[model samples]
Target: MLWAHGSRVSRLPKDRCSGITPPDKMPTRAPWQALSVVLILLWGHPRATLACPHPCACYVPSEVHCTFRSLASVPAGISKHVERINLGFNSIQALSETSFAGLTKLELLMIHGNDIPSIPDGALRDLTSLQVFKFSYNKLRVITGQTLQGLWNLMRLHVDHNKIEFIHPQAFSGLTSLRLVHLEGNMLQQLHPATFSTFSFLDYFRLSTVRHLYLAENRMRTLPAGMLQNMPLLENLYLHGNPWSCDCEMRWFLEWDAKSKGKNSQCDSWMPSPYRSGNIPFSSMPVLLCLGSA
Candidate 1:
């Protein structure tokens, strides 16, 4: 008889004389041998419980943490059932379309703090169920129209702290559900009028659902007229930390700001010092003392 310890089987009994079978009468194999073979085969089969990839830890059933792993690319064998994946603080340089091909149930993807320079078209199209995507602190230089396609359900996006210099007019085409966007700390100098506008039948009244927009810490000197017209639902707009020039080109914004502040007095508190200067013409302010000129 064999003794059992937890899930392991102990050694066989030392008594060899008891219940011994004659050599001529013994069967070719023990009766339990076939049963053991079946058990081994079943245990070796791939299943959900054994799907976690190497070096990454799955502390919960639906979340996978691969942060700080020094990974060069997305790891293979990620379970399709996983809902959240944290790939932050890795050395990943690029993402292929197949990186997350079958992960349709994925909702949150954190790939911040990497060296990715650009996202290929359709690379993230498979993430239809994704709600939150964090790609900040990367090396992206531009956002193309197809870079963010098929993310119909995405709500919040963090693309701040990159080197983005331009964004295609249709880059945000299908992101109708977006609520917040971060574009701060980049190299942007200008923006197209339709950069944030979605296609609408009323040509002059295109709109976006975004409530909070972060455009601080960039190189923009003046905003084009009607840029903010597309963001009717905007609640908070961060424009600090840019080299804003108080010139005739910004007259429309000053008028809009005054009108908006007249209706919503509380919004004045969110304005930078130069914008909050009451009853003073923006051009009268010394060019050297303009807000964000530092």
Candidate 2:
């Protein structure tokens, strides 16, 4: 019997539960089990939780989609482990050098449908592992030589539907792995011979590796001689929707067009009288009189 604060309490008999162990004689947890608990608390669970960026959904471990968010600029705190980033349909006007500084694992970057006017030199130098880049439907006016310095592994580039007026001679110097280039719907009037060729002092040239090239709907009247001769692996060429001057400067293109075995080499121009609604092939149409003798 035990005496309480204001009443007396009765105790149970010692033979009530003879199988039960006393409090001091109970066995303790093994040392290995206690060590595992401590390790789990320090390292967390196996499926570790990810800290996603605000206002952007991270559904997978490698991709981050931030499209149509009305974002004026690129958001901060993006994970470096991400491989792909989609920032399309935004109002981003500019990109700094540190925009993608430490994201070495990034492969695909899509920043199209924005209002970018120009890119500073070395702004994209950190994207060493980049493969595909899309910059269409923007307000770019020129492509400087240093604008695309460090994209060594880039394959496909889309810069169409912009306001590009000029491209420097060495604008595509280090892009040896480039396969496709889309430059349609721009305001380009001319192209340098060295734009796609690397000249050596021994009077030889190394051609580019581009396969598909699009230069449609531009303001080019004539292309420099030997422009297409450098692209040996070119499969598709789009040069329609331009007022071509059928003169001696264009006679080489006509001869090359007849002998080339490319799949799609469209160089048609829109006619008015009989072919108003359709485009006539440059080789079949004799109505385009030569402005000068070839």
Candidate 3:
């Protein structure tokens, strides 16, 4: 009788089969819940690459049009493959660093008519392949160093038709691969010498190729000295339409004009009259010697 009772006890239910619960023990089936929490955290990063559907413009599949939207801040839901962005005709007043964090493959950013009062430093640090940047026709009073830090593959930059009064020193310090710069129709009071300094890769660029610079039709009295220093064989210079300040301070421009053989700049009918020599337009000379500052 004892042996039969012992065998019955051994055949009884195991812990899993038993529905009975021990009050002292906690539940153990919560591993899957913990794994779900980890997944949620991983996909929530702002810089993570995503795929968003394209709108009307066919040229840029990953591109988003925030135009005429009066968007005061950066747009969200950008895909990873976005190469060109057109935020023109918007009212974007400000931008942050990670505003473009989701677009790792971005190449061009166009912000033509926005009243962007300021662009924070390192605004484009990660965008190395950016080719053309346009900020034409806006209310830009000043450009800060924080605005331009890491745009290594930048080829063309246009900042024309605006209220740009000054360009901060070291503002264009890290822009080494820049080929063309357009600064026309602005409210510039003073020009800086470091405005057009090139730092790397000078040989592959053709002498006929454009390190082309356009400083035309604005409030420039005279260009800062040695502004074009160390620049080798620059092509297509257009500095006409400015009120040339013909003075002793404007003599260096004359010297550079003589050495350039008329390709580095175009100054015609600038000085009043060289024969009389009071304050002729600097354009008249092979290097025009204007009498007073513009």
* Cα RMSD to the true fold for all candidates: 10.5, 8.1, 8.9
In candidate 1, which residue ranges exceed 4 Å CA deviation? Answer: 1-50, 202-205, 261-294
Q: Candidate 1 has which clashing residue pairs, if any?
A: none
> After superposing candidate 3, which stretches have Cα over 4 Å from the reference?
1-60, 200-210, 263-294
Model 3: what TM-score? 0.68
lDDT (10s digit) by residue, model 3, range 23-117: 56868658888888877876785334444433324344656666676777767667766788888987788888787775557788888998887
Candidate lDDT scores, in order, read 0.80, 0.78, 0.67
Tally clashing residue pairs in candidate 2: 0
Q: Which candidate leads the pack in lDDT?
A: 1
Q: To one decimal, what is the Cα RMSD in angstroms of model 3 from the true structure?
A: 8.9
lDDT of 1 by residue, 35-102 (tens): 89988887776443447787899898788899999999999989878899999999999988788887
Q: Which ten residues in a row have the lowest lDDT in candidate 1?
A: 261-270
Which stretches in model 2 have alpha-carbon errors above 4 Å? 1-50, 198-204, 262-280, 284-294
lDDT of 3 at 290: 35
